[model samples]
Target: MYAIVNIAGQQFKIEQGQEIFVHRLDGEEGAAVEFDQVLLVDQDGKVNVGTPVVEGAKVNGKILAHVRGDKVKVFKKKRRKGYQKETGHRQDLSKILIEKITF
Candidate 1:
């Protein structure tokens, strides 16, 4: 079975035993977390979709690690204006292991 769930304001398509990196969450490594905002689920040939979100549906995952994503550089320049800017950023992320989806 697979499910589309909302985690940390982002939607992810997940399946059992799969690991995904999402926006940083408020929990320590190895902690258990549950996401209730399941938008859709498909089991074999059966499908269940929610109004906004599926009622009585949930996704459970375990926090495997906390990490940072790759750095992104931003550069801006204006010709003949002698203006230039450079910046970089990296996003904090958490690795989660999807354990199960239940309704």
Candidate 2:
């Protein structure tokens, strides 16, 4: 079985035993979390979809670790003005292992 779940305003297609990195969540490593905003679920060739989210459906996951992504550089320049700006950013993220989907 698989599910499409929403976490921290982002949607992810997940399955059991799969690890995914998402926006950082407030929890320690190895903590369990449930996502109630399940948009779609598929099991045994049957699929259920919700208008926004499926009622009585949830996705369970375990937080594996918290980490940061690769740095991204932003640069700006103005032609003939000798004006330039440079910045870099790295997003915080969490790794979660999908455990189960229930409906």
Q: Tell me how candidate 1 scores on lDDT.
A: 0.96
> For model 2, how does the per-residue alpha-carbon lDDT over 30-59 read when each residue is reduced to its tens digit?
999989999999998899999888899988
Query: Which stretches of candidate 1 lie above 4 Å from their native place?
Result: none
Q: Report how far off residue 63 is in candidate 2 (Å).
A: 0.6
Q: Summarize candidate 1's per-residue lDDT along 1-103 as a digit string, tens digits.
A: 9999998888999999999999999999999999999999999979999999999999989999999999999999999999999999999999999999998
Candidate 1's error at 12, in angstroms?
0.5
Error of 1 at 55 (Å): 1.3
Model 2, residue 33: distance off in Å is: 0.6
Q: Which prediction has the highest TM-score against the true structure?
A: 1
Worst 10 residues of 1 by lDDT: 1-10
Task: Give Cα distance to truth, residue 3, candidate 2, Å.
Answer: 0.9
